[model samples]
Target: MPEIKTLAGNLTFTECPRWRGGRWWFSDFYTHAIYSMKFDGSDLQKEVDVPSKPSGLGWLPDGRLIFVSMKDRKVMVRATDGTVSVHADVSAYVAGNPNDMVVGSDGVAYLGNFGFDLEGGEPFSTTNLLRIAPDGTVTVAAEGLHFPNGSVITPDGTLLVDETLGNRVSAFDITPTGLGPRRDWAVFGQPPKTMHDDVFAPDGCGLDAEGALWIADARRGRVCRVKEGGEILETIEPGTGVFACMLGGEDGRDLIMCCAPDFIEHKRIAAKEAELRVVRVTVPHSGLP
Candidate 1:
């Protein structure tokens, strides 16, 4: 177990954290706002107000911030001067709202969607993984995902996407144009839970220097480290409802986690009032951006 910290007190549904420009940037889905702060949780700044409920945050090769606009199922880009624009409109491809994302070294942004209205009283299996080019072109990378969530590209450029409702993480080779053949990188249902998210249940994720996948197990309240061959190496039990995680801190070796132990009950009463919390653990490898 690691020591947890309140990066910002009682955030209204926070998810998707990324490190950029020597700061930690994240989003509050209900608040529809993006924020940044120092490593010590100081100098918090409201970077932008994205009305579509921003979730994931990424960066372009040229230093522009790219984020997922969930309600619209689109990817948006924020320039250095803070201008936001639609990078890709993926409504036609993704079955539901976009959730989490990861940017590749080739400058392409890989995004996932909610698949169904998890909190809107209607649940259906319809989600897809999408890719957005540097020039704002949108294309369907993979389809039929139950609820695609967090994702990351390997150092060799292979793309890994966590199919939340599917209970498995899938891998695909990234080409100059789009994704290649899909393969199961990891699956998580041997030990089943009655109240698990219908999909994979894995949410926010990142890549380790040793090519391992660090997944935030939302329903299980733990961070699982999965080997490339789909083996569970280690698990960090937060003992609370975990939402997301990112490798940050001074050396990028500190694992920063976003948790809300009361999210399940909170969502039932009001989907917008979910709390935000974070924790840190010292690890061996720094994470991918």
Candidate 2:
């Protein structure tokens, strides 16, 4: 219920905001760059450059940073010493570009795909979810998904993924090898028709301590908190395109939203200028990465 404040300016399509090592890291999909900043928007640094576009971010138990390379359809990792390398190649598993990802406690990274083109083109509808192991091996975890975007693993090792095109969120039991059969976790009834970019539809998300899902509703310009039974608990409206968000601030109660300019009339245009913003809320839950 608070107005969102701009944290940084001049971002070219920011997505996948994650909090790690006392810093907030994110990617500019258009610029193909990864950046990090302090909670107060200080000491901004360019972490690395990626091939094509980069989205979703995760960290290994060994302190390595992992992110999805969209156009390349691969998972890349950056070491603490600033070395970058390909962690997994999943071109054969994903139908389109890899979009967002979440690292599990078992050290495996669960990734989802954009499932289609965004520039007013047709989607590959064959989009699927993949799991990348610590040894750089890739395997299909789920298939026939309608553009799997933001995803997170529960504290008990349950994998929950947001199906943007299908307007629902699904859950799967996590195993050492891969994911189990999925069940319905939540669904967004009657998503706004103004939504176009399937990749940014129900974009980024976070998990609360009680296992509730907080989704950044890009097209609706709001953040919705949903229960495990697909019930809407609350909705926080942050004007503009709420591309992504993360829970970070002094008390770990603030929600930082990565928002783009309104595009109601120009949904097909690929203009940037999305501002990185933050808003404080009464909820005091620290988020899971």
Candidate 3:
């Protein structure tokens, strides 16, 4: 077993972890803030606050910070001068609040959404992943995804998306116009019909140097190191509800796990019980955040 340790606590649901500019950066959902810290958990800093609640985070080529504003169904951009602006409004194409996002090196972003009223206990439904160009033009990159959550683009230009309710990681070829044909990168089991069903619910994830993915198994309260074709190479039970995992650090072997008691909106907002945890791994991180 790999030794796990607490990096920081007193958070209310952390997500969208990325290792960039020599720090571990993440968003605390209920707190509505994004934070960053050093390898040993020192120098913790609250980078910014998003009143609509922030989720996934990435950087544009020009150094602007772009992130998901979940409740407002928009993508926000923070410039070097700390000015925040709406990068894109995707409410017209989405059925529910937008969630995770991964911006490619070329400055194009692929975004995901819940597909239903998750906290309100609505039934599950498929959704689309929207592609936002550098000019902020929004288009449906792909459709029929069951709760497309965390996403990453492989070095070879393949986009891998975690379908939380679909029990699989879907892949698509990155093309000039948009995405190409869809394929299954990894399948856990049959897609769960309801939220209460036995499910893995892959949330935020990170890619490793060997091309495998470290996926946060949301409903299972664990993190899984999975290979292509649905093979589980390893598992790490963080002893809490692990919502997101990212491989990053000085050498990119630090697996940062976001832990919380639960994901209920009200419950998380009521207390600061969430934590950021970490464990060391062999492979360095690879691909887009």
Evaluated with TM-score, which candidate comes out highest?
3
Over all chains combined, what TM-score does candidate 1 have? 0.88
Q: Give the TM-score (vs. native) of candidate 3.
A: 0.98
Candidate 1 local lDDT, 232-279, one digit each (tens) = 887887667777877776776666677765555356236443434455
Task: Report residue 174 deviation for candidate 2 (angstroms).
Answer: 0.8
Worst 10-residue lDDT window for candidate 1 reads: 191-200
Q: In candidate 1, which residue ranges exceed 4 Å CA deviation?
A: 190-200, 262-287
In model 3, where do residues sit more than 4 Å from their true spots?
none
- Cα error, candidate 1, residue 17 (Å): 0.6
List lDDT for all candidates, in order. Answer: 0.75, 0.76, 0.92
**Best-fitting candidate, scored by lDDT:** 3
What TM-score against the true fold does each predicted structure earn?
0.88, 0.89, 0.98
- Top-down lDDT ranking: 3, 2, 1
Give the winner by lDDT: 2 or 3: 3
lDDT of 2 by residue, 1-289 (tens): 6676788877677888887777888988767799999888889998989867888888887878888888877788887788888888888886567888988766788888766665457644546788888888887888877678888777777888887776778899988678899888886564423234343356688877666777887677888777877788888876677867767666767778878765332431356577788887666554357
Candidate structures ordered by TM-score, highest first: 3, 2, 1
